[model samples]
Target: MSAFLRSCRRIFWALAAFSGMSNLLMLTGSFFMLQVYDRVLPGRSIPTLIALMALATVLYLFQGGLDLVRSRISGRVGRYLDEKLSIRVFDALVRMPLKTRADGDGLQPLRDLDQVRGFLSGGGPTALFDLPWMPIYLGVCFLFHFWIGVTALVGAVVLVGITMLTETRTRGPARASSRLAVSRSALAIEGRRNAEVLQAMGMRRQAALRWREVNVKYLAANERASDVANGLGGISKVFRSILQSLVLAVGAVLVINQESTAGIIIAGSILTARALAPVELAIANWKGFVAARQSGQRLDQLLKILPCEEERLALPAPGETLVVEHLYVGAPNAERPTLSEVSFALRRGQAVGIIGPSGSGKSTLARALVGVWPSVRGRIRLDNAALEHWASDALGRHIGYLPQDVELFEGSIAANIARFDVHATAAAVLEASRAAGAHDLILSLPDAYSTKIGEGGMTLSAGQRQRIGLARAFYGKPFLVVLDEPSSNLDSEGEEALTQAILNVRCRGGIVVVVAHRPKALEGVDHVLVLGDGRVQSFGKREEVLNRVLRNPVPLKVVAEGPGGGR
Candidate 1:
């Protein structure tokens, strides 16, 4: 957080400099009034009055210019903050723990960043900058007379106390309201994403009831915060008004005693008002201040947990040799490991088939191999380098993954195949599509590769989506491919294409690991791994593993009858 703050320190310094000048020049009006009452009016000197008025105009113009410069500097600071933190926040979201991502609104950090930016660019930060100059105005009051200075000082202290009180009263409710607001946003997003399922199953009413419960909580919290802040703002306003009047009353007493002139009375009142103005503004905008504070804290915590990438020597791009040693992995925060002591090795041109019962950790192994999920113990290495040693983006280019749940983004079929890489060439996308056997299907569309798909490929059929996902996995001729149920949604023709795709990858010396439920899907694989209850039951040559499973029928029930056929 300090590092981020330092990035915008120069802008903040400029803002402070301009704010100081603006405040200094703000005394122009008070001094002009003092001169008119003390000297110009008494002497009835027209020339002197005209000269003072002209000087006042010049000072006012400069003051206004300084205010404008300060405002622009603050705005620039806000934009700089956004530019510096937006990408980091997004990267943090991507690298966040799976459990955390599942349990909360992943997009809240983005909203938090926006809140911080808005506060900095808006009047909230300006009020804060002006707050330090309150005593400067109070000091000027002291120069006028002791009693006038004491009155202004006391008023400033009271307003500061009120501002503190407002913060104390509203802090908890404001934080709670912010959390509930994020919850409501997450629920809304989830509802939209799963709208089809809810509507088809007549669960929309239930979803609405759930949403209403959360909305009610948010409303209660928000109202509590608003009530406290508004009550405090009103009190601060009334107190400021009374304090300004009190300054004049005290100054009048000084005049009666011949201790000060009438000019000092009006000037003292104005200076007192100026001194308390920042405090009043701070109280009025306390909500925004609280929100920005919370946002900064959240962003700081998030950045801490999601560490930035350290500079490391670039490891060579992985070849076909992939090894997993004594690997243990679990769903994030789960009590039990999903895959225990899982170990395997694959070399160039080898295609391994993983057949397992449901919940037996085949998909988990695939995720671990592709670096989507962190392992609980041991390591996965590619060409003698631990997976973590390689930079994620660099390693990702040489690896391909296809999870059981096929999903596609909003784009043309070719873009999806190219992994939406803006720099991907048309030839490369075409080649990958042809390898996945999706080329013919894509060409059948009206616009071919230029056809725009809906979000999550809503416009495409299940088979089409799966095929496109396979093409994504096969993109760039990656050295290692992990496909979990890649053919689950494919028809017979699509299945044939998938089989051919696997064979093509092997022929190209790429290592392929396919998690399959059907026996035919495992055909042509060089090695076979059978898992039962998260442990490897059989791992050997394709023929040997298949023969052993067949001879022992009981253990092979998972592979023979499919994933869900056995416990």
Candidate 2:
């Protein structure tokens, strides 16, 4: 990130140079007034008037051109910053929930990046650049007259003070607004996601009330910031006008005393106005500037904490063994580890079913196995290489994961089954689908392979989505397949297909770990790892572990096969 910022120095310098040229050309109007009133009009010189107009016109064009270029460059700078940081911000967003359980922080990083980019592309940067020239404009005023300079300096000071006040007054409110915005956004998203449940339970009104509470707070914060900024901006505008009038009044006295000419009066007034212009502009843009600054700080802190993934050597696909050494896994920032001291090993072509009761950390163990959660202390190795030794994308290609909640992207059935792989082959897609027993399901769909699944696969049934998710896991013939609750939503036929899928993976020299509560899901596994309260109670052949667990009085929730229980 620092390197990227350093690269932008050249662009900023270019903007600075453009601003300088633009401001220098700004003198054209005042100088033209002076030349007209003092030289052209006095001598009744049409040629001189024509020459002055021509020169002023040319200078004005140059000024416009420079300002235009600066504006364009400012927008490009924002784009460049977005290009540099957007993916990083998105990466952070995707990993955010894995770091904490605070829904209030949802999407804040992306919003921060937006705030920064928006400010840069807007009028805020121009105001910031022009602010430094306040002294120079005042100096030009002094060249006209000392009193005029003093008056301009006084106005600048007051406006600058207002800018400071604006900063302070809006800073806290702006930050609060941003945070509340995140809360509000999260609430809205959750409401949408659970809309069906809310409607079914007739809780829409209550949900709306909750959303109202969050929205009210967001609005209040925004109002406070906007009110202060608008009020200060109004004051600055009125004061700049009053300052222009007062400078004219002072000039009138000078004219009456024969201390200055008409041209000096007009030119001095123009100089003072130009001198104080930046302060007013700064006041006007102070809110966005403050928001941008806060956003930048947040981005810095977030990036520092979760910095980009370090480059890692790409290792060969694992087809030998999967090993876990005293693995301790838990939810991020949890009070205690959810799964502790879990050690296991599996060779290629082996399948293990993890049997445990509810809240036994079966899902947690599966997540850890697939690199969803970082182990607190332990190591997971593939083919004698630590998981971290391989790059995430590279490792993902060799690992198949079917999460408990099968959330599918908005795309066709084939796309979802193929894991959205752009280069996926038709044969590979069909092969995986057939392995998951979803080929017939796809054929029955309205568009078959071209059928759109919609977001989260909302258009499909729970069983169908789960089947597609299973197909995705089997895609590319990954070497390590981990399925959490693989049969939770499957019908008898689907379960049969799932069992076959497990067998298919095992036959292909891949290791499969199935997290299950039902006995039917364990039909294809040769081994079973029994967990109780996050600890391994027993690990051995399926029959031996089941017999041992059944002999114990307080066995983990392994139950009888019956209707509505286990398939």
Candidate 3:
């Protein structure tokens, strides 16, 4: 993380230089007043006054320019931060373990990044930079009179104590509020995503009530933090006001004793105020500082977990060969494996059907095969190379997968079918659609391949969505294809199209694995792998395993065509 920040060191250095110049010029007002009272008024010299005013005008203009330049530099620093971390955060989110992903909102890291960026560009950090110059103002005050310097120094100490008190009282509540905000956001997003199911089941009120519970907690935490910060800020403001007036009183007393000039009294007050301004601003913006600090810590942790990029040798594109060696996989956070000690080897031009009851690990096997879920034991290799050994983007090009829960992005149908690749040609997309038997169906739509779909393709029927997903899996002519419950929503015509699609894949010498609960969908499969209770029950030629399972009466249910051709 420090290395990443060092990339923007040049801009930080520029900001520091500008801030120093600006702080130095900040004494112009006090100096101008000092010259007027001590020299021009006492000497009755209009010429001197005019010349002094002209010099002050140029200094003030230069001060304003430095201030503007620093602000622009700060903005550039914020952009640099986002540019460095956004892609890494996105990659971390994508590669996070499934259990971790489910336990918290994935979007929180992005929000944290935004918070950090906003703080760097805001006044909070600028106040911090100006804070180190407070002593410069206080030391100048000492030049006027010892009593005035003593008073200003005491006030600075008191304000610093108050700022510390504010942080001490508000830190816990601020952190609590940030955490609750993230959780509340996650619940609201989940509620929105599943709104249809809740509405149909008449559970919208219950869901809303549950979400309100978390929201109330979030609000209460925020209110507590705000009350503490505001209370401390008000106290700091009152102290600062009283301190400024006290400086004037002290200077007046010294002037009455004929020890200091009238110019000293006014200049002392202005310098005292300048010394305390940064401290007061810091107190007021303490909450934002705390939040940004917490966000930085979280982002640092996320960066630690993200895999580092290495210069890997580009391996050759894999053929239709998959080997699973004593593979074992479990669901995220599950104690027992979902698929245990399952091993199989598949070659080119072969179609395998995985049959089992619901929760029988068929879908789990499919996920493992496609590298969507990691195995707890053993390895999955393609063309003699372990799955993890291949670069992710390079390996992805050789695989196609259609999960049981079909989800589509909001875009034109052709874009989704082409995997949203900007370089994909229309001819390639149409060919994939044709292979999935969806080209004619797409043409029947009002806008054909140009039809716009909603989030998750909610505008299409379930069968239509499934067929489009199948077309997506068929895109790019991948070496291996895994489809889970592909026929669950398909009608007879759609099933026929699916069968033809599987045959076409085999003809092209690609490997196809289908996880199906319906026996009819397994027609023409060369091999069968039956699973039960996270263990492989049988694995052999399709007809041989089907015959043995049908001949023997086992606890594992076998769904095949019965003697009279009835399921």
Candidate 4:
């Protein structure tokens, strides 16, 4: 609220100044017109006539200048607020809990914010807060004659009421239309994202039909809302015309009775329009306010969500081992736990391979180890201390993770490799690349390490992308290295390279836990854990786990080779 107020202050002050100057100037002009009619024309001095003309011209010029300044400053203030709000919202999103982000519906905040830009740019009510003369003009009318002022004010209110009534009748349809439009927009985005797949499946026509259905639904609602709004606009126009006619009639009568000067009557007529302008606009843009209100509530809800300390990123610690004790974790409002009664410890320099079928909770365990699942009902410790005790930055430095689906930024190869450490020398990157078996491939490219990878490394083959991901894990010599499905999308050579990279991390006295499906990749690991249905089926030395697997042929084919070289 403080921020919002501060953002509005400049515009408010500018509006106040503009309103005051315009009113004073207009009043001065009214007095001048009266002097010209009642004094100048009746054999007044030439000097007096010149003086009145000069003063009126100066007042009009000053009014124009004040209005110009107000408009410019108000626009600048609105833009500044737009930038500030966008930055704050983005920062909040980055800090939001993973679960909350995933469960939330859409990117409507961004869209609504865009609409807010239009509203602000339209210089709506926010820009009129300082216009005190609007009321003062009416007060002047009342001072001249109470009944006249009362009639005008009442007419203004009734005009506004009629406009608002019409708007209200269509509000529901307007909101429904907005929702339908957003839905169609989301579908369009989804279709564009999967255009390749849709083409492959020959479903483009079907997709187009679905898109047409959504479009028709959205258009129908929009047309209904538009029709109702136009009707309300017509009503508002009639009321305004009636109000203006009454003001003119009253002003003419006053002029004839000599109760008010002709100049004052004319000024009063203009004031009538000025006074009702904001009311008319306020009624017309009630929907903008409604939308803003809804958007604010959503942002407030997101801000109000409690932080989950466990999943939050923490600083690295100079710890040797990571441990979990009977950890239990599940999504909010879920009846069954994703993982429960799971206990494990990773020692310094240990290599542990976790094997499981799809949906066996192996990936969840990996995520838990990285502190992404903070609501788990158990303890995770680093060097015998609570995981939360460590700072997020420090913790990240001590751990390197390669998710099953690789994520790469759109940048040159060197840029991605040096992301965590900007000062990483070429030699260090080359060494890491070699370990991951990507150095030769990178060198084969026209630009070598300087080669620009497309967004998410889309330009690279799947296997090459996986190698780059693996190479990033080796870039930093973290205490713990976690690789989930490192070889799932890799070919024979890529798998060989990934296995060697794992060996390299292990050789450096770093703990490695890899979720693997291939037998060759698990070779020579210090320990093996077989998981099924969120429970540990077996956990022991590599040889022991292999013996059990041999008894009952492993679910994933495990081709073995005596402790030797390549696959």
How well does candidate 2 match the true structure in TM-score terms?
0.97
lDDT of 2 by residue, 1-567 (tens): 455668999898999999988888888888888888789878999998988889899999999999999999999989999999999888888887778775674778888888889999999989888888889888988887788888888988888888889988998888889888988888888889999999999999998999899899999999999999999899999999999999988888888998878898898888888888888888888888888888888888888877889888767778899999999988999999999999999999999998777788888988888888989999999999988778888999999999888899998888888888899999999999998999998899899999998877899998899998999999999999999888888889998999999999999899999888778899989999988888998998989988888888885756534212111
**Residue lDDT tens for model 1, 435-535:** 89999999998899888889888888888888888889999999999988877777778778888999999999999998888776787588999888888
- Cα lDDT of all candidates, in order? 0.86, 0.87, 0.85, 0.71
TM for candidate 3 is 0.96
Tens-digit lDDT track of model 3 for 415-491: 99999988999888998999898999999988999999888798899889888999999999998989888888887
Q: How do all models score by TM-score?
A: 0.96, 0.97, 0.96, 0.86
Candidate 1, superposed: residue stretches over 4 Å from native: 97-102, 551-567
Q: Candidate 2, after superposition: displacement of residue 131 in Å?
A: 1.2
Residue 177 of model 2: what lDDT? 92
Top-scoring candidate (lDDT): 2
Please list the residue runs of candidate 4 whose C-alpha ends up more than 4 Å from where it truly belongs after superposition. Answer: 1-3, 6-49, 94-97, 101-106, 125-127, 130-133, 166-171, 222-231, 255-260, 306-316, 331-335, 420-424, 552-567
Superposed on all Cα atoms, the candidates' RMSDs to the truth, in angstroms, are 2.0, 2.0, 3.0, 4.5
Q: On a 0 to 100 scale, what is the lDDT of residue 27 in model 2? A: 82
